[model samples]
Target: MAGLRRGRRPDEQPPEVRMTTLPTGAELLRYVVLVTGVIIAPGADLALVLTSAVRGGRQGGLATTMGIVSGVFVWAALAGAGLAGVLVASATGYLMLRLAGAAYLLFLGIKFLAQSRSVAPPVDRTGGAGKARSFWSYFRRGWVADVMNPKMAVFYLAVLSNFLHPGDFLPGKVFFLALVHASIGLLWFSSISLAVGRSNILARNPRVRRMLNLAGGAVLVLLSIEVALPMQW
Candidate 1:
C-alpha cells in the first residue's frame, strides 16, 4: 500500500491513486501512440541503423535493423508475458517497475554512446563468401548491437508509462505496446532502407559512411541525454 519510488514522480502520487481509476481505451491508445512516436523519432535506434547502413551497406544495415526490431520484440514479449503482476495493481510495485525501467533505459543510452565499433572485416571478391559469418554471428551482431543500444531501453520504458493500466491484463497490454513499438521500428527502418536503396547518395562516398557513423553516435548521445535528464510524470 505504500507508494513506490517510481510512482513518486515530480508531483504525481503513486499509481495507487491514479490507477484505481483505470484509463479509457482511448486514453490508453493515446499513450500507445506517444510511445510509438517517441520510438520512431531520431534517437539511438535510428542512429545505429544509420551506422549499419554506412558500415555494412544496405543489406547489412537491413540485417541490423531486423535484429534491432527483433530485440524489441523479445523485450515486449517478455513484458507482455509477465504483465499479469505488474499491470494488475499494487501501486507500489508499478511505480517501482517504472523507475527501474526508466533507469535501465537511461543506462543503455549512455552506454551505447560510449561504445566503439567492431573491427572491420577484410573485403573479398565474393563479399565475404570465403569468410561468411555464421548465422549466430550475424544474429549476435544484430542482437548485441541493438541490446547494447541504451536508447532502446530508454524508449521502451519511457513510452511504456503512457499506456500501462494498473490492475489490468499485463501481458495483453504489454504485447500490444510491443506491437506498436515494433511496427514503428519497421516503418522507420523501412524508410532508411529506401534511402539506402538509392545506393547512390550514401553509397558513392566513403566519407558519407563515416559521417553516418558519427551522426549515429550523436543521435544516441542525444537519446541518452533525453533519458538521463529528469523526466516528467
Candidate 2:
C-alpha cells in the first residue's frame, strides 16, 4: 500500500519538450565562407553578370545584380516555407522545373549564338534612345535567368537543409542567409562590372565580343545538359 501510494500514475507523466538549437557563430562563419566561394564560382550567374557588364556598362551590370539578388530572396522564402523541399521530393515537380530550366537555358544559348553572327556594336548602341528601357531589359534578364534556374532550388534543399535546424525559426534564418549571399554577389559582380566596363579593348573589339558570346552560349548549353541529367540524390 505504501509503495503504491508513492508511485505516479501513467496519466501524471510530464510532457516531452522539444528543444530548438540556433546556429553557432563558428557554423555561421563557415557557411558564409562556403556561400562566398559558391557565389564566386564559375556558373550561369557569374556568366550573366559578365555578359551584362560587357554589354550595358556598370549601371546595367549593377541593375542585373540587383535583380539576381531579388531572385535569391524569393528562393530563400520558398525554401523557408518548405515549398522547395516539396518540389525536390516530388519527382513530377522536379522534372517539370528541370525541363523548364533546361529549355530556358537552351533558348538563351541560341540567342547568344545568333548575336555572335551579327555586326552590331559590342555594347548596346541604343544610347539615349532607350536608356531606361535597356536598363529594365537587363534587369529582367537577370531576374529570369536566376529564377528559372532549378539548381538554386536544389542548392537550398540539399545544402541549406544541412545547415538549418528543423526546430529553429526557419524563415528568419533563411532570409538572413539569403541576404548574406546576395551581399557577397553584389560586391563581387559590381567589381567585375566596373573592370569590364572600363576596358576599351573589350568594348572595341568585335572579335573578342563574338568570342565571349560564343563561349557564354556554349557554357549555358552545357549547364542545361547538366541540369537535365538525372541525379542519384
Candidate 3:
C-alpha cells in the first residue's frame, strides 16, 4: 500500500476544493430589488426619517440616514466575523438587548405623543446658528435607535447569511452586500426627506403635523410591543 501510494503522480492527488461561484447578474438584480423593497417598507426607520425631515428639513433626514447606515455597517462586520452568532446563542444577551430596545422605543413613542398634544409646532432649536450640532444630534438619535434594536443584529445574522457563499473571503462578500443595502437605504430616505422637506403646506398645517406625530408615535409603540413579545419569525 505504501509503495502504491508513493508511485502515484501529484496530478492524481485529490483536487483542491473550490469556492462557491459569485452571484450571477440575475441573482444580483433580484437581491437589489428585494433589498430595495425591504428598505422602502414602513417601519421604525421610515417613521424616524419622515419625522426628522418634517422637523429639521433635508439635512436632518440625511444625517439620520447616515447614522442608520453606520449601524448597518457595524452589524455587517459583526455578522461577518461570526460574533453575532454569540448573541444568537446566548439567551441572556439576546433578552437584555431586546428589553433595552423595547424601553428605548417606548420612550420615543411617549415623547412623540407628548409633543403631538402641545400647542406649538416642533421647533428646531439649533436655528441657523447650530446647524452642525443639530445634525450630530439627529445622527446620534438615529444611530442609537438602530443599534439598540436586537432585531437588526438578528436580521443580519439570519437574512444576510443566506447571501454569503461558503469561502475564506466571506467577510469581504458580507461587507460588499452591506454596502449595497446601505446605499439603497440612503437613496430611499433622501427622497422621502426631500419630498417632505419641500412641502411647506404640510409643514405649516398644525393639524396635519399633529396627526403625523400621533401616527408615528403609535406606530413606534406597536413596534415596541412586537419586540417585547416572543414571536417566531
lDDT per residue, candidate 2, 77-173, as tens digits? 8988889899989999989998888887778777777877864674454767578788788888888888888888988887778788755667667
Q: What order do candidates take by lDDT, descending?
A: 3, 2, 1
Looking at candidate 2, what is the lDDT of residue 102? 83
Please report the candidate that would top lDDT against the real structure.
Answer: 3
User: What lDDT score belongs to each candidate, Candidate 1 first?
Assistant: 0.57, 0.80, 0.80
User: By TM-score, how accurate is candidate 2?
Assistant: 0.83
Off by over 4 Å in 1: 1-28, 81-139, 148-169, 217-233
Q: List model 1 lDDT by residue over 81-149, tens digit each.
A: 544234434556545444454454454445434432433321433546532453234345566645544
RMSD of model 3, in Å? 3.3
Flag clash pairs in model 3: none
TM-score of each: 0.56, 0.83, 0.86
Superposing all C-alpha atoms, what RMSD in Å does each candidate have to the true structure?
A: 12.1, 4.0, 3.3
Residue-level error in angstroms, candidate 1, position 121: 11
Q: How do all the candidates rank in terms of TM-score, highest first?
A: 3, 2, 1
